[model samples]
Target: MNGIILPVDKPAGWTSFDVVAKLRSGLRWRKVGHAGTLDPMATGLLIVLFGECTSSSDEFMDLGKQYRGVVKLGVTTSTDDLDGDIISERPVNWDEVLVRNIVSSFRGEILQRPPAISAIKVNGERSYKIARSGKELSLEPRPVKIHEITVVELSCPFVTIEVTCGKGTYIRSIARDIGELLGCGGSLAKLRRTSIGDYQVEDAWRIEDALRVPEFRGQR
Candidate 1:
């Protein structure tokens, strides 16, 4: 049995589970699993563990991650990203100076509330499942560290940002919290995971490409 580490560039519209399923089938290994979960609307690097490599999943999970994203101000969604129900919309006049200031405030330690429609478990059930059933899910704020946050570009309501943060930090939550700080509601318009610790997206193989490799096909 080979313990190979595969980095996959997950495309949008496919859940993390989808990627794992495809890898499992392609590699013919029932032991394949991913280090972290990325939402269907997001794309980028996913570290996949196969065969005997599954033992290293915890090491990859602890590594920091970097992401680039666009937050669309003036809109608030139930999920904090583009996938969920739109809760409200308001006018936003985002200038470079204003955006810079808001981005600055997010650096260092911060408390963030996870979106109601998230994978967080509450009372032994996923929060999103509870939220989708029309039940109110109240999530407590947790401490998260933002190592760095920079405003990459700005165009009216759309502000692009690059963020590097600790494990388990949610970029969507950062957008929503930043919007609150600026008095304009916001939600993630786009997101891409650029890197995870020392692993860059450039090194990741596409799912289709990984499937064609004979070494991957013989894992089962």
Candidate 2:
């Protein structure tokens, strides 16, 4: 078999690997992998590759991604998202003009530091492991391309935005930086990946459905 590319609408609370494992078990495929990793708190399009397709994971990962997310202002966290412990709180007193201006400033290329509680490797070990061990790791900022960011709405402490970015761009970091620019810390409250390259969540399968599809079931 040449294998297949399966677009999955990954539910929250499941790691990217969890999706791969489920399919591997259900379909009994020897080789299965996911192109990109989404935080457990996030839900969205996850590209699942099987068999020979697994070899092309890097190509899928390098494609641009789109997301819709909500950022909560006035609070910072150990991680850059709601999954982490709260580190601080501040008053959110800002007008829409200021918020919009600052949010728009993140357009184009920018250096962003990955969250400590992330999959990035530090000294051959996952950075999150180091963080969980009660140690601090200084991660350097790297360049990522932000194609576009639109402020969808602003309701007091919550700011909603739609983002299109290149590989390695973290929306959580964008929220964190925006809050810093607004004089109040911010953390990603909610996130949903909408698309990757031409693949959209609209066409993705829920885990259970994918496992039961006639074509996929027949492949086994």
TM-score for all models, in order of appearance: 0.96, 0.97
> How does candidate 2 fare on TM-score?
0.97
**TM-score: model 1 vs. ground truth:** 0.96
Q: Give each model's whole-structure lDDT.
A: 0.88, 0.92
Error of model 1, residue 132, in angstroms: 1.0
Candidate number of the best TM-score: 2
Model 1 regions more than 4 Å off: none
Predicted structure with the largest lDDT when compared to the true one: 2
lDDT of 1: 0.88
* lDDT (tens digit, per residue) of candidate 1 on 35-65: 9889899999999988788899989988989
